[model samples]
Target chain A: MLSPLLSSSIKYYLCFMQTVIIGSGNVAYHLAKAFVLNRIPLAQIFGRNENELSKISGELNIPYSTETLQKADLYIICVSDHSVEDVSGTITTKDCLVAHTSGSLPKEILKGDYRKASFYPLQTFSKSKALDYSKIPFFIEAENEEDRKILFEIASKISDNVMESTHEKRKYIHLTAVFACNFVNHLFARAKEISDLQVIPFDYFLPLIDETVQKIHEIDPKSAQTGPAVRNDTRVLQLHEQLLQGESLEIYKTMNLSIKKMYQLP
Target chain B: MLSPLLSSSIKYYLCFMQTVIIGSGNVAYHLAKAFVLNRIPLAQIFGRNENELSKISGELNIPYSTETLQKADLYIICVSDHSVEDVSGTITTKDCLVAHTSGSLPKEILKGDYRKASFYPLQTFSKSKALDYSKIPFFIEAENEEDRKILFEIASKISDNVMESTHEKRKYIHLTAVFACNFVNHLFARAKEISDLQVIPFDYFLPLIDETVQKIHEIDPKSAQTGPAVRNDTRVLQLHEQLLQGESLEIYKTMNLSIKKMYQLP
Candidate 1:
């Protein structure tokens, strides 16, 4: 409700606070859904790709624009790492606090004549598969305390596991995430490939993979580590190497050596 | 619940329908616990080391044996992979079925005039942590139909997910487990090392790790894979490699290359 005494512009700002999400990739799509799911005043979603944009627009039943300029109190630039700066630049949002959803990019990349921050959800999100947003750890960053609070407040609304991180600390989160999420998934992929070759369904490794992750939840992965390299089982290691060739062979050897050195195996 | 037999020899076999588990290691300890938990007749546990063996004996309230030959209908050799042959050799249980719990080793390894078999549980068992044996896949194999049925009956009693796996298939499962469990855990370990160096606790990677494992349950890992390497983002890949050094760098580079090659990225 707008008060008669209040200025029209001030009343407009007070009456409605809206968010415009940029991009339509996995992170963008999931974030958009989560924002809507939480009723976070999501006004518009902008996607460069017409097909993907329409897909998101239809799914969320929200107004979307391919136009660079969209009016919203908060503009979340959720695009690829390379295009984050470009997306921020294209958003002609003024006075609004703009943030990019990137784990690696610094907050400064959000280039607009407005306050900026990086609103990074530290999790691997797939668009179709809905993630538990409340469980997702969010790393928010901004220069000013006021703007930071605004970002933090909005982020906290979505996730209980929210915290302010410096660009330095947040970037390490990105690098480490690559190892944990990306590299770990690759290991699963390689392992799956190996199983597929042997006419084994990928399901054979599910229990083992679940336990591997579950261990870190209870104990440090360092002590939870086990296998040929840790046990110094050169015979089995040789047998495994015999099955792997080319790139996988190199990976097995390299990781084996690392594991051996990490544990200082005999 | 045994009916009286006319002869002492028939009564000896009928009265002692029990299992003797050899070795007090992770697999043995967990198997012993699971057996009792399921109300299976686990009569004795044997370990070369008196200290560890006594710990298991006292905990399970089962008789501890230093002697290799403990009377039971079945003998399960649950020693290390390398020690399976030697452990099976030491067991002198005639007529009773002797099964070594090893994914890689064949049932023939068990020496003496005993019906040989393999009863491998496909999981990472830690003695301190009790696993849900019902969910763990139990792989069984035996020399003869009678011995096989005995192994199957016992394995099925503890686990619903029981299957017959030949030595050939079991070895492949063992190899794949190394890739999925051992290699995946090392990635977590390395990620933890990176986080530790930067004074960041390993909690941040927890959600991502959980999701990575979760994704495989819903979708195939090869299709479920996401990251800079799969996306062919050279920029972020280069950045990740730059942050990593020594063995970590090699691991990053090798994995990145494998992911790229696996996806047939340029």
Candidate 2:
């Protein structure tokens, strides 16, 4: 039966928001889980890795497609930043609103015969770690109004935190995240290594680490910053430098200088 | 009327454990505040700066001692790293416990006619921030069994998270904390600046920061690492390097190499 809205666009409109998530990494895993947890089921998952795709699909009870991009209302390519272009090029559907979940890449990368958009979740995703979707900021950018509205609706259903972040700003956030998340984690890794070398259990650091994060909850990062570098405590700083070696020493000195410069310490 | 314990030896014994916290810095402020809040009043506060000491003393209604370390059971010198020895030297009691709240300093620094100890709280403190004393890990070290027992009892009363850590191990933890707390906070400061320069608000990095800390709540830092450096994505690494400069660029390269070396990536 043909409805009043039935036209050449009827098929595309019917497929509009039904999603097919591509890739099976951290983002894809969590996003797929979020869809199911929110009762917004994914239509299929397209990925080249059979082992991972099969495991993910089997767990979610969604069909897995490895051959090509399946027909759906939306195709979310969750590949690495470098592969976003290549992966998006393969999904050539004029009707579907195609999006890649990358903070660094511009939405234009997904522009093709199909609709273009970005569905970046501005949070770290680890496979084993559980996270509340409602707290995760979902940054959506679409090629057009219709696609934007659809993406917004989908994102809103999945997470309470929805923002229409532009490509340019998201890129900046991505860079900052490298410092806040990635680089900070590197620091923690180094801390563990240092503690291990000194024959102290890593558990001694948990409270300090927790307090460091908890400090920023009430104060700005600048005001919350404290250490020998901030205090310009040359005695303690030199003693620490003497204890470290190689890359650890380099990072210690580099970060020390960075903190000194930040605080305008001599 | 005089009791049997009121003799000359008894006089000094009664003074033991009654604390006079020295200095009014962040550590001293929080420790004094904690003691007050916990209904355990500090006997006095000795500060070279009368203005700061008066303010804190008036707030807590504790006596402010500027002339010298007032006779007390415990004199906790919560001064700077370089001043621990000097501060400890001022207290020339024969039997009272004299401790410094310095993580880097050895208990020997407080060695004198008085009993030596360390009452280091292993957490970052800021005047503007409020923290639950129970969560702060107090690392206590003492010269004798009686002093150790007293310090443990006091620390336990203030914080459930108390440990009898040695000077050597505590020093190692302090070094690790420079990487975990101080250095990471420095990274957050840098992230905020980079984000500001790019015209992005610092709030965008908060969620990322929270998640970075949250990730470690469940897993080890090494297992939780996710970024270009861990993935060894040289393309994105170079792109990010291009956007950074000076100390930021140096930190980027230093941290990148550190991560690579840690992961043993080519």
Residue B91 alpha-carbon offset, candidate 2, angstroms: 1.6
> lDDT of each structure?
0.82, 0.83
Q: Pick the candidate with the highest lDDT.
A: 2
DockQ list for all candidates: 0.73, 0.72
The sequence of per-residue lDDT tens digits that candidate 2 reaches over residues B1-266 is 23444433444553444778999899999999998897775889898888889988888888897886677777888999988887777777787888888888888977478778888898888888787888888888886666776677678778887888898888888998889999898888888889889777777667778888888877899999998899898877887887889888999999999999988999
- Residue B64 CA error for candidate 2 (Å)? 1.4
What TM-score against the true fold does each predicted structure earn? 0.93, 0.92
Give the DockQ-based CAPRI class for model 2: medium
Per-residue alpha-carbon lDDT of candidate 1 for residues B80-163, written as tens digits (9 for 90 to 100): 788888777776657688888887777877667888888989888776665878888888888876566666767777888888
lDDT of 1: 0.82
Q: Enumerate residue pairs that collide in model 2.
A: A15-A73, B15-B73, B16-B73, B17-B73
